[model samples]
Target chain A: MKTIAALCLWEERIAPRYDRSQKVLVVHLDHGKAVEASTIAVEHLDREELCKTLIAMKINTLICGGVVDPCRRTLEQAGVKIIDNVIGSPQAVLSRHLAGALSSGTVVD
Target chain B: MKRLQTPIPPELILDHLAVGVFTVDPDFLITSFNAQAEELTGFTRKEALGRRCYEIFRADMCFEGHCALRRAMDSKSSIVRERANILDKRNQERPVEISAAVLRDKTGAIIGGVETIQDDSNRAALEKQVKASYSFGDVIGKSPAMQTLFEALPVLSATDSTMLILGETGTGKGLTARAAHNASPRREGPFVKVNCAALPAPLLESELFGYRKGAFTDARSDKPGMFELAHGGTIFLDEIGEMDIGLQAKLLQVLEDKEFYPLGGVRPVKADARVIASTNRDLASMVREKRFRDDLYYRLQVAQLELPPLRERREDIPLLAARFLQEQGALEGHTARGLSSAALKLLMEYGFPGNVRELRNILEYAAALKPGGRIEPADMPRYLLRIDCPPAGAQRAAAAETAPQSDSTPDPTPERSETERKAVTDALHQAKGSRSETARLLGISRTTLWRKMKQLGLGW
Candidate 1:
């Protein structure tokens, strides 16, 4: 059962693009319930390094803003499912994701 | 009533301009967004302000930190006519031309960054412009890696920080060094190249920091070192990893103090030369092993650019080959014009261990073997035919696609896949999911193991 998800970030707000994000908020989900979350500095990492870090963290679903095709494909190839083009604050974004209402292109004010 | 013409605010003048304009604070949050910016990015000024500019326009460069505004701010220079693609509010691709610079306050302190965008949706103009800047100095590359490096060179050249260039053998380290020097503000200064591996410690020391008269038996007259000769210019240290640890300390002093002591002189002479070092060696490992100085390594790499080898960016092979062949043709009385497509395909399939230098040598050999015009596969060195490539149709399809390619396209034969699967699975089981051990047991490189795992859907 897949559970771990990562939300790419810019400060407290979800960055509009995955590649440009400086941080990622990693969350652990149990039976669709949010449980634990933490942030990892991701600004210094290149696309491949960023993918490797997430994969090492066992993240299966990545919730973020627009992802350039190359970055999305790289993550997908590594078995991390990407839900891109999302925008909102962490609380709002995580809430929608917990409700199973989060998807690509979701703009939560 | 006399008509009073209230002077139009300059802010309104900016809004009416055709070019898209925007400003970002130090944190990269949008401080202002103009009307033209709204039309180009599909994000209104209200929606953009206070939000990060990256979210509004998901540009390819932004994701990789190759941002134009970021570059301008870092290198304290302006970026003009750089090309980038972004996704609009509607998620539609918007091709844009960027010109950017750091924004300064009243006291000339950098407060933020400002950028102007020009619509570059005209494919014809984009292609034509791309061709003109395909090569920087003598280094030519159209691949993404080269393009990124090309953008970085100007940014790096503008600063005075010590630069360390990393690359494999024959990967144009020298050309890149020369290119950096040419583009740098110190272009008029003498560019000196010193190979650290070339001399013994004593000779190299004296050569670098010249000896005074009567300092040694051989020193009959006062002589200036490479450091002195390179004053007001750039000094390139090639193969810096091979620099002796003892000499490295002195070099570090020069880097830190901006001066070096002559072999026999009492006073420290000011060394005004800028330093750019290059090496094909792994300095990090050398530092770990204590063969290289850790402090020097840190200081030298304050700003570094790495040149990718030929095998990793195979898309550049054809372009590089054409340039080399054309130059070789001119050199050999027009004996070689170009390579046939079949010849190019064979060259692409081969992993060029020697990088660009090897390609040049091979072309020179072929040019000598063939009298004139397009060189065919038969005219090439026999050693280049070691690898068997996919069918021509598959290669064509790959060339036609502009998107990122899969791990390995034109799928491996079923027999090969079955063998790889069994070997990898067995190795993984034995290694207990340790990729390094699996690769070792299977006698394949680590990167190869990772690619096979992805291709076979055998993620651990």
Candidate 2:
């Protein structure tokens, strides 16, 4: 059983793009967790609210297209594991995360 | 040759010079007049000969009835360079400079005076031209804020990097963005603008990334979005805070990839557009609330520029007002006379809540009321004239009473405010009460959030 978050591109279902402020979806999984997932919108939330909401939701990982420097530092300080630059459907990206096959490169584009 | 040397007549000597000349006896009667003087007055020398100089010129004598002739008589010396205005037979006023000398007999006894009057009409016309040329462009001030902005503009213009402009609504953010775009390498490229707050999410999405033919029910034909149209150009997103969460994420992707898929389109299109976003709202706060995407915020904020509000740069009001006046005057075809010293003082003392925009509006309104007239304090708006000068004691008492309540009342915070409070709490909770991390998630400087928490007495 593993829970992973995937921040996907809205227009392209094939590949997901990272959010500018590094926001992603928390995908709950345990072989069969009904594919239930929730997105974290960090566009308006400051660092404090963003961290608090994620922790309250008990998200294990954050997958976003892009992460701002301040939020990246704050998330790293909170001991959150970041798997960035993952684009696609939540289900497809979650499979890669579970199989330990996600790229760790920072997506700035 | 030595036989007949007739003494040159004084009248003949005076009549030939181009300058007007006239003389009055001690009796104040016109005694001598030259041809130029006759031409200037529209009267022949024969008609003006016996009339009083004041009667011929239609001019009141000096304050003490002391004309140039009277001065020569009193001092028994020549009175040179005396200036006055004279009225001709037709009552046309003329400015004249006069020179007079006392006529003395062999015994050195004082007599009537000989006065020379020269027209100064050309000099007056030249003075008028000089005054007209001194206008708004002459407004000068050396404030640190202005100096800093001027120095920063060149550097900001050199790059095509995304700029995040932060300032109050009327603080000339749009102007600054235009200046930066105009100065940049993209000067020749199209400069597109989108007001994030003015349009709804669906329209904004379509506007930014054009939809394909039959993309939606109303889709008629292929249209280029701002991203495509502004390719090789700059796009300004104003009030970026109002954009929806989904759009924010999409925008973030576009920034990251420099590519986007039009709505309902199969292919991804590459966009080579520079982004410049501006907002009065606190994006960092929105980020913390999970309303704004954190990643997008960072991408858009590569180079941040913050403008001071009008209140912060009050010294620029006079310069801004003068510029506005000249612009309005030129458009309206009137002389742009500047404000009186008192009016300038009043403007400096008032706080401009609407910033530079409001100042322009005020000047335009004033100009409409009194075109080409000197702007006195009375000409200012009624509200500005009645500004409350609060007593120091009252202000201190008010601050003391109001300051504690905001921190004391932690109960029943309204929905939006409470949501903001909750958002802060959530960020703090996830960060394990780490203020610095919380500030980052909140998208605000640590100092600002620190002050907010301290004011609310929300002990972490």
Candidate 3:
């Protein structure tokens, strides 16, 4: 099944913490194939607003690093998969996702 | 203090330093992490090296364009000393003091950045003296009411009886419960909590007592409740007053029998858990209204403890305010150092309807509005300043109506500026009219204090 994922960004690397991320790279996938990708600025959004934005955008999963309860719970309740405490570039993480070898707390060099 | 003439290796010196030291490349990757850095951040040097600073440290300042190292490297500037909070590997939000400076080669080209970190958890506690003389867990107090409560805590924790904690909202009822559990014989066991008001009666009942597979339409497998999870430990039922009348009967049964039947199960499970309940509601009134069960109330209150509100313990205001100001971690920059005398006086005179929680909210709001330095009366919320300051121990502002009609009588309840003037005057007198000494007494710079004195016409 195809899905949409948002990779929290810090420059070119995945943001270490989702709560502090100012930007997110959203990628659309279809059967392990990349369909589309775009960058969205998220600095102005608070925790609630950020969750609402992700849910409203039809985002199915969030790829990021550390995430506390409030943000994690809100996203989880909205049926979004939160893969957290991850490290490495967004491209490498997304590639690993396609290879079916990615999960929470995964560290990619 | 004399400078040692001995020259030490930079690596040896960095390893021996008390503060955590780390250097990052321009790509935001960690180049080096010292021994102290590894211990303080709960990550080994091998795990931290070559990783992003944020991935290893997880400092709160790293998010939303506030990365301390990034800011220093980009601006070609240095953060000499700043406060931050970091989540360690244990998921503990530890307070840290950070200093970051951009690294430059001999050619003056920017290379990377170096950051030094100090665990400020202990320092802040000692510096503010919030964990002062009388503290039970994180709950701190020094008043007679609190002192008596402190004296009784040992006795309360020495037993295994069900304890009911009564207090107004946000009065540390949960904190007291935790303190009791920490001091109890079951300290090694699990501590579970459930807010009866947060869930519906049916869901709350399921949450308190386990259910078996096929117990209900959606019951896929065996699910253990909070009571089961808290085996050999303590279960804190927060806001127990909100428990439904029907569920209260079931709870009453559990308290009496120490065993309960999981839904749709024939076998009974023994509850080896100690129960501690807390509420801000008047359970007695609820009993009269038939909203709460009297049997359950009696069972829960076998060992009851009452917590005093913030107004009654006004003597601890300064200490609490100082602590709250230091706790303003999520703010953009440095937290407020301390409250000015006028601000302290204002806080003491005002009645806190929301208690300690409200006090913290007010200080956090003030600190966010105005970044670093001492918080003044002007920084307080308008709601706080709008209310009339009453005389100590008085419920209402009767001073203005009851005071003698003479300027010589002194303002029975002086306004903010008047209070500030009196504080300065007293400091000047104590310092023997020395401007520098007076400034030291008031915890302000000589120039700032002198300007205030001149502006207010104190004639010092």
Lowest summed-lDDT stretch of 10 residues in model 3 chain B?
B397-406
Please give the ranking of all candidate structures by TM-score, highest first, separated by commas.
Answer: 3, 1, 2
Query: Each prediction's TM-score against the native?
Result: 0.47, 0.46, 0.48
Model 3 gets an lDDT of 0.80
**Candidate 1 residue lDDT tens string, B178-206:** 88888889999999999887788889998
Candidate 2 regions exceeding 4 Å error are A1-109, B1-142, B387-460
Interface RMSD of 2: 41.1
User: Alpha carbon lDDT of residue B386, candidate 3?
Assistant: 56
lDDT of 3 by residue, B1-460 (tens): 8887997879798999999999998998899899999888878888888998888999887754588998898889999889998877654678899999999999999889999999999887786664444777777888988888887887888799999998766578888999999989999999898888778999998899979999999999999988999999999999898788889999999999999988877899999999999987778877877878988988899999898877778998887887777777434546448888999988898766446765776787678667887888898765467554444443222211121122233343445446556656765765678897665544344544655676457774
Sorted into a CAPRI-style docking class, model 3 comes out as acceptable
RMSD of each: 28.8, 33.5, 15.8
**Winner by TM-score:** 3
